[model samples]
Target: MDATIAALEELTPVSSSFAPIDDSAYIRFARTSPGTRTPVLIFNAIGVSSELFLPLSLSLVAAGHSVVLWEYGRVGDDGDTFFSRVQSYKALLGHLRAGLYDLGLEDCHAVTLCNGASVLARLQAELPFAVSRAALISPYFNLLHVPHQSPYETALVPLLMKAATDEGGAARFVHSVLNRGGHAVASKEALSKAHMASPRSIAGYSRMLRDYRRHDETDVLRRVKGELHAFYCLDDEAVSTDYLEAIRSAKPSIGLSTYAGGGHYGIVDNPSLLADVTAYLGGDR
Candidate 1:
């Protein structure tokens, strides 16, 4: 790790060249980094929507690790129904693997946030890969195995699917319901603007909730072959401590990193989390 960072410092002798992308919807790769250390491959939380994980990806790249943001936009037919299941990730895993081979990043450290970790964990269990380490940030999986009381997230799966399919009517209904109930904070305008912005992700979330049993995150956690690390904010309103306890019960081998604050999306909003994850992925741990 030191050697890789040394190589990075040698190559990049100036300030960090991280560019800020609008809405955090794009990915930027490391132009130069030693491949001796494992690469960090991020699985964007909501299928092709890279917004949630973009900050961490940028941090890892700035820290001189080759961070590969996955490509699921080209998946499925015109990328509409992509990432609907673990098989979807399986399909692109080969493509991602091929890209890694081309770039000499075959050995990897898998990093994902929220629901995407479900698919990623299942991928490792069903079809093992070369991931030596994994980081799941505020993961919400095993919906059936665990208990949840979020009306908008759980009870409204069908309605959410409708919102994804026919956004005109259902989106407003959902946004109104969730917003009125203090569930989500996206502006009504933002919700409306998301009409066709990420149909694939919207649809996939519906499936994730509807078919939660298929993910079997508990089994995946128990069966994971690498050093699995799960991060969470103790006070996260969205994902509570019960979920953390469930993960511990499922697999005692997995490591847990809990913080007093940072909430659900702390990896993006918290500077300490950004630095900690960057250091961990850079092989400092």
Candidate 2:
């Protein structure tokens, strides 16, 4: 356990980076190894933050793949996200797309859990950079139950939407609700006091939830250029397992795996699921 904690602390001494992706977005690159081996890019889950990817990131980087972990200004604040710089989600996406193109990271394998899956799927396909392989873990693609949301979402999101008018206050409230009841502690208080006190640039993260659910699954899949792998944790509360059928129907050829256990962020604690995901992203599969 000591060794594991040491590894996590060592890989990303800082949970997030201050270097702005744009006026509002930021990335938490745990480790960067530029090499001939294909690189890996992990997308950020909404409230979970990119910090949760540390265990997975540590494994991937140790396997010799350059790994970049990123998160945008979403409706939640785990102390890692900068709500102050948030523009609309569309603007942040544009910033990331531009940055990826500038760095020539066009062929990287991409992995995302929850709402991050939506954004990764939305990246413009016309760009020279094409995602080689994508692994969607407990994906929260909202297109499922198209006529309505799953039970969990129905109970919680409306309240959040109503509260988004107060940016900073809403961020904390949303964060508290999405903290998985503290089931996942990797997103511990890692933000600096100064960073926390930084002035916010946005009026509020009012459009975030709407932005995630607006993408078309089929269209997003059409844009991806490689094999797609999805991990469905049957117990995930933020996103239900029912979405699997919707995703499967959208892309019948896409690979699928299911686990009856594990929370929304449970992949970190469930070593089997962790290894399975690592093999897929690390190309051992």
Q: Estimate, for each residue in 134-231, the C-alpha lDDT of model 1 and write its tens digit.
A: 88787767646677644334556568767545535665565455445454332232222222234444555455344453445566666767777788
**Runs with alpha carbons beyond 4 Å of true place in candidate 1:** 1-36, 74-104, 125-129, 150-158, 161-168, 175-215
**Clashing pairs for predicted structure model 1, backbone only:** none
The 10 consecutive residues of candidate 2 with the worst lDDT sum are: 191-200
Error of 1 at 93 (Å): 6.9
Q: Write down the lDDT that model 1 would get.
A: 0.55
lDDT (Cα, tens digit) per residue for candidate 2, span 48-74: 445566678777766766776554443
